[model samples]
Target: MNPYEIKELSPTGVLAEMGVEQGDLLLSINGRSVVDELDIRFLGGEEEILVEIQKPDGEIWELEIEKESDEPLGLHCDGGTLGIRRCRNNCVFCFIDQMPPGMRDTLYIKDDDERLSFLQGNYVTLTNLSEALKRRIVDYHIMPINISIHTTDPELRCKMLGNRFAGSILEDLAFFSEHHIQMNGQIVMCPGYNDGEALKKTLEDVMAFYPWLQSLSVVPVGLSSYREGLPALYPVDAQKAAETLDIIREAQDKMLAQYGVRFVFPSDEFFLLAGQDLPGEDYYGDFSQLENGVGMMTDFKAGLRDALAGRTPKSKGSHRFGIITGVLAKGFMEACAGAIEKVYPGADIGVLPIKNNHFGPSITVSGLVTGGDIVAQIPKENEIETYFIPENMVRYGTEDFLDDMTLGALSQALGAEVAIVPVRGDALAEAVAQRLIGG
Candidate 1:
């Protein structure tokens, strides 16, 4: 059994009280070998635990700890947080496989780790699960795991995922369902593959799990322009998007009548592509799949309405700012800008739609828009004093775009201060209000 090295210990934690210090190796918890933080969390949750630690000077310490069941041990371990398991299956519609070369190395990592699914809400295919891992999950009671269930048909799943063992997806789903494990599911709908009857079958099959399986999100496959030698795949066109929504609506009606809740939902992209108005907030039932682009537009619009209602109309001399977004969200951003302008009469907000040249024009989400495209596409004659870019445009925890362009570089090129605004409508409203009031 491999031991995890204790990187840092909380000053007031149980470990600190037990004389455990930094650089000590955490050997085991209650006789079970500690694999990662998850193991520590699951096994160390008991009211009484036997913790084994090894010192750098070859001293082994066995510390018996007694604490409240809900109290955390509060010790940070090195390389124990993200023991990320790499993906095994080569799915035909994998977005990472379609990424352009020579970008950030982390962009290409294919993670199908269930640990990530539980920790970060990343959807994982069950193709990589071993019996030991399954036992760990069941024993640990890792509730509410997100699963990428593209299809339920055994043969079809194997073909789509390019994994011979992928046919066991239904069995995996059954295993979790039988064990009373709570889960959320995702289906990446490929145009001609799983869009029609296959999607219906998948939905029907998964619906058997009901409240335990919970909600499922059906998002269209993202096809990038870099798929040269890869399998030929078609984008979900306007017609197909409409057809897919019809199928989902039919399933939703059935599920609502049977279960009092719509168990399945189509993403916002489907509605945008189908040229249909977004559904109201009541349809989303807590916006569980907001990160998956389901009901995002409706939620944003609702938030903006509430935010605008709370603000007092103010006129601080005429101040202009640009709202930078991707081509697909141009109209949406324009509408948002119009609402902000109404609240702050002195604010002139122009919506600038930057074409996604780096990942090809087909990829239209604002989150995927590269900084290189923004610098190249912004009009040279633009007189905007500042630009409000969505926080998603930059990588998490940093102000750098996918193309490695720094926010400072963008500000310098455009001759304007760039402000990173959160994706929420209230945040945008607050940002513009502060800027207007300050100037």
Candidate 2:
């Protein structure tokens, strides 16, 4: 095994106080070989540890150290973060498969790394998890690992994932539960395959592992337009969305009665598709699955209401502003803007719904909306002073869109200042209020 090279040390940390410097290599902690951050985190949790390090002059030092259990040693090792494990399965509903060619190469990566699931809340299918990795997870006591469990039927799961080894999903889940590992789950519901009776059966089977499997989110399969040679998967239409919601509701009712907490939830897309109203805040129960689009609309609405309630109406001004969103959220966004206008009637906020020309019309989420589509769809004669876009439109930590369109380029093309706002309703209200009040 490769020794982790120490790149830096925190000045006040125990390692630095003990004369451990940069350029030294960490060999092991408490006789367990250190591989990545996870290893450091797990093994370094003890109040006392024997850390073995190799010096630059080839001197091996065995340091007996005692510190607070939660105190970090502060060794920034090279490649300390867990390396990504690429996905091995070819699921029929894989979004990467439906992506059009000639975009960023990183967008095509299919990551099924359990480490990512633990650290970043990414859902991973356990198909690629080796026995050693499983043991490591259990040994490390990694809790709340998110899983992508499409179904509980072994044969059906294998077929959906296109991997024969995928049949062990239930077994893997059972092992984690038996070890008292907390986990969250997801189901990408595809019509005609894992909907209706299949979905009901899957929910019932997984409910057996309740509390350990804390919550499950059922999201409709996202079908992009570029599926030319891929499997002929059906998108969840109005009828199908309703049916799926019904199944989820039944499971939730049972879970509420037995476990006193709703264990399953359907994404907001299902309610929108089925023409049903979003449930109030009580139904979401802390919004654990908010990242998965569960209760997003409800949360946004609640936040907006709270924000609006806290603020005094601004003086009337003629500040013409624009809000950009995907076609699916156009009406909802319009209503939000209208509510703001009621309090601050001076600002004229127009909601523009951009069609997903790049990913096809069926793909109608604001996060997937490209800057190219925004530029193409906006009317040239519009006199909007500033355009507000949800931060999700741009890639994380950068202003570039998925199509490589930089925020500066978009502003230049549109000939208007574009501001990226957080997806929360309060952020939108604050942005509009700030501009309206000339703050």
| Model number with the top TM-score | 1
TM-scores of all predicted structures: 0.96, 0.96
lDDT of 2: 0.90
Model 1 CA deviation exceeding 4 Å by range: 80-82, 310-312
Please, what are the lDDT tens digits per residue for candidate 2 over residues 1-439?
6788898889988999988999998999999999887888889989999999999999999999998999998877777334578899989999999899999899998999998888788999998898998999999999789999999999999999999989888898899999999999999998878888999999999999998999999999998899998999988899998988888989999999998999899999999999998899999998999999999889999998998895666664678889999988988999999988887878899999988999999999899999999989996678998999999899989999999999999899888989999989899888987887854
Estimate every model's Cα lDDT from 0 to 1: 0.90, 0.90
- Candidate 2 — worst ten consecutive residues by lDDT sum? 75-84
Clash count in backbone of candidate 1:
0
* Candidate 1 local lDDT, 1-439, one digit each (tens): 4679999889899999888899899999999999887888889899999999999998999998889999888798876444678999999999999999999899999999988888889999989899999988999999889999999999988989999999988889889989989999999999788879999899989998878898999999988889998888999999999999999999999999998999899999999898998899999998989989888888888888898896678877878899998888888889999998988999999998888888888899999998889988886577899899999999999999999999999999999999999888888888888888862
Q: By summed lDDT, which 10 consecutive residues of candidate 1 come out lowest?
A: 76-85
Q: In model 2, how large is the Cα lDDT of residue 169?
A: 81
- Tell me model 1's lDDT, rounded to 2 decimals: 0.90
Per-model tally of clashing residue pairs: 0, 0
